[model samples]
Target: MRRVPGRPFEPEEYVLETNTILFRVFSTGGMVPRTVTDFNPGKGDRTRFAFFGDPTVPVLYAAESEEAAVCESILHDVPSGPGAVLYESFADRVCAPLAPTRDLSLVSLMGDGLFKLGTQARYVTGTMASQYTRTVRWAEAVHEAGFDGLVWMSNRRNTDRAFVFFGDRVEAGDLVALPGTGRIFAAGAGFDWLADYLTSLKIEILIP
Candidate 1:
């Protein structure tokens, strides 16, 4: 995956292909094309689409049936993207944050409620301990937001940081919500684990 560098490091174009079809997926501030025809590879091709709410996170798409509309672009990068089977609709009622909530506590919210991170948590177990670094400004932002320091899973306490960056403007304990989509952008391994914890409470998280 290519990372476009700037304030927000976004993944470069992800090209998806089928026997007779081609799809290019891009994440522009979380704004995904609304329909298949909205961004058809060509004038009269059958293309379908879907995306997540996170503006910076990379998204995925798949086609049920398609045929290659011969073009110069479709000939390359045909095997790089993920292969997904099309569904009439891919709504995740269990995890979709269809409604917003006032509660911002990471642990107190229930069943798809949005919340903020209370502190800068880290996943220090397995190989994750040595992976993912917080950019200098981002690290400063995490602390300035009054976040409690790093969090680790199990008994791992090592604070080795990698060059991987997280959302910069967002602070610790800040509510992670994707505007207009009724969902939250849960990034990093710690929040990923938090989503699992929420699942234990019968809450499904819409992590983009």
Candidate 2:
């Protein structure tokens, strides 16, 4: 690979351009914004977010972030939880990495986006869990299945969202890549920014 700049640049990146049809479903799935105002990030955060694009390979769309995104609920930082903090911490196989709660919290803080690893990512850096194996698991269904991406309808500023692109629908539209199978697409009714994008409902990676 060419020398990776401080910021890895993807020359073949694209978006769905129009995925409103799918996002309408995401909104109905209760994944929509709970509070429109909460969607907006501080002015400082918004500015920074715009400048820094997502880095996941085949990076899809970016989700709007919230100051109080209730991450603690999903990523418990306490001493113990129902599962391992970093699933990788306990993983012997590479396809089923687990990240209980604490691990999620730790990794989430390591970068700007979630579960993202670009071809340009530094040597031995920015890897969350290498447990996912596409050859043995239906990972494409999740990453490359049909879903393109999920964009948060946020009005926030700097605090931006993270994403994991699915690649099943490569022919879908304008989207960011998520390593192998992740894609980003437009799903909502008025997300004009994503005129050619297609968000995914579910993903499944094929096990070869």
Candidate 3:
């Protein structure tokens, strides 16, 4: 694995089609807009691709698939084996499908993209939470280079891709929520679906 390059290099670009649907698992009735890109500079927890120290350069994250979105968000901190994921974790969370109103030019963080960046997958995409500070520098570099966003293999579910779009770069009308496809993971069809999905992974949802 090559060391993370200090100087910014030209990143490979990947174009996301307007037809590709992305899933974002987020909380409802929160301070931020429910289905819109989160422009709030994150306060407490550090995130993988969030631009650090720049309120103007906010970010929004999503996954290529619903299962990948759930794994990356709701189940992100749940430990493997015998660990119980609490029902409260899903209480206000919903997965919404959204699509770009136009094609997005994103920095590709997979395949030959990593090779060009002088780093490995684990360094950029698979690091633990504690290393987010280091990882975010890469994002800052990407933002500095004026890319629309980034695309990487999900650390939680590597088979699927995860995305982060720069709020400043993605215009207000860039993404639109699809109707009738949103699911609240706490109850009804959402809960039923989550339960079955968890059963397959041998994880239980504990209600308190």
Candidate 4:
């Protein structure tokens, strides 16, 4: 599917999605109109409706009920790779920051929660390793420079670094929250703020 603007990466902690969606296609037989519809996540994952010109006598809809009469459906791409489908959502979670096309530094925070650097080389997310990036900037300062980052599993963006960017200002011990998993990744004026912000929101799915 094409990436939509408003779509959040995915929740870091726990991600869930339907295994498959229901689709319907109606034939008009030169009398009515044939309709096609796909199951979406909005207005609930399941639904039913009746519209005129439904030449097939039934309407098109997407739902999860066992009683649902479907014309056709495709299964969700369950990842067979090491860590693909293992997570709940789509691989786009890891795909985003790793998406080398982006402009930012993505460090790892590992399950142990420590600051670690990466070899992104800019403009390509082809990862050299599967380590989790941390948000805490220990030595580098983020106040003087603009910062951008997100949390894993959570789809929130942390712009809290604005306070540091505008002024040569910073408190001795100030803290900020990340998007996906609301965890305190790091503290420092040297590192970019967005890095911590993004490391927090982690959602991913593998496409095969």
lDDT of 4 by residue, 1-208 (tens): 1111112222112111222222122222233332222112122222111111113112122222211111011112222223222221211111000011123231221221121222121211111112112211211222112222211211111111100011112111121111232111122321223233222323122324
User: lDDT for each of the candidates?
Assistant: 0.22, 0.23, 0.82, 0.19
Model 3 per-residue lDDT tens digits across residues 1-208:
6545456478889999996888999877566646644544564477877657545477788999999999898888777556678898889988888889999999889999898877888999888888787888888888888888899998878899999988888888798888776888878999999888888878898998
For TM-score, the strongest prediction is 3
For model 1, the stretches where C-alpha displacement exceeds 4 angstroms are 1-94, 102-131, 135-140, 146-208
lDDT of 1 by residue, 89-207 (tens): 11211111111122211111111111132222321112231232322222233233433222122111122211111222223322222233312213444335434543443434332
Give one clash count per candidate, in the order shown: 9, 73, 0, 46
Q: Write the per-residue lDDT of candidate 2 for residues 1-208, one digit (tens) a residue.
A: 2112123321222232332112101111233332111222211211111212133223222332211121211121322222223322212211101111111111121133222423222221122223122111222222332334332222222244333333222323232222221111222332221221111211121222
Better of 1 and 2 by lDDT: 2
| lDDT score of residue 196 within candidate 4 | 31
Higher-scoring candidate on lDDT, 1 or 3 = 3
Displacement of the residue 189 alpha carbon in candidate 1, Å: 28
Candidate 3 residue pairs in backbone clash: none
Supply candidate 1's per-residue lDDT for 18: 15
- Would you list the rank order by TM-score, best first? 3, 2, 1, 4
Question: What TM-score would every model get versus the actual structure?
Answer: 0.15, 0.21, 0.92, 0.14
What RMSD does each model have against the real structure?
Answer: 21.2, 18.9, 1.8, 23.9
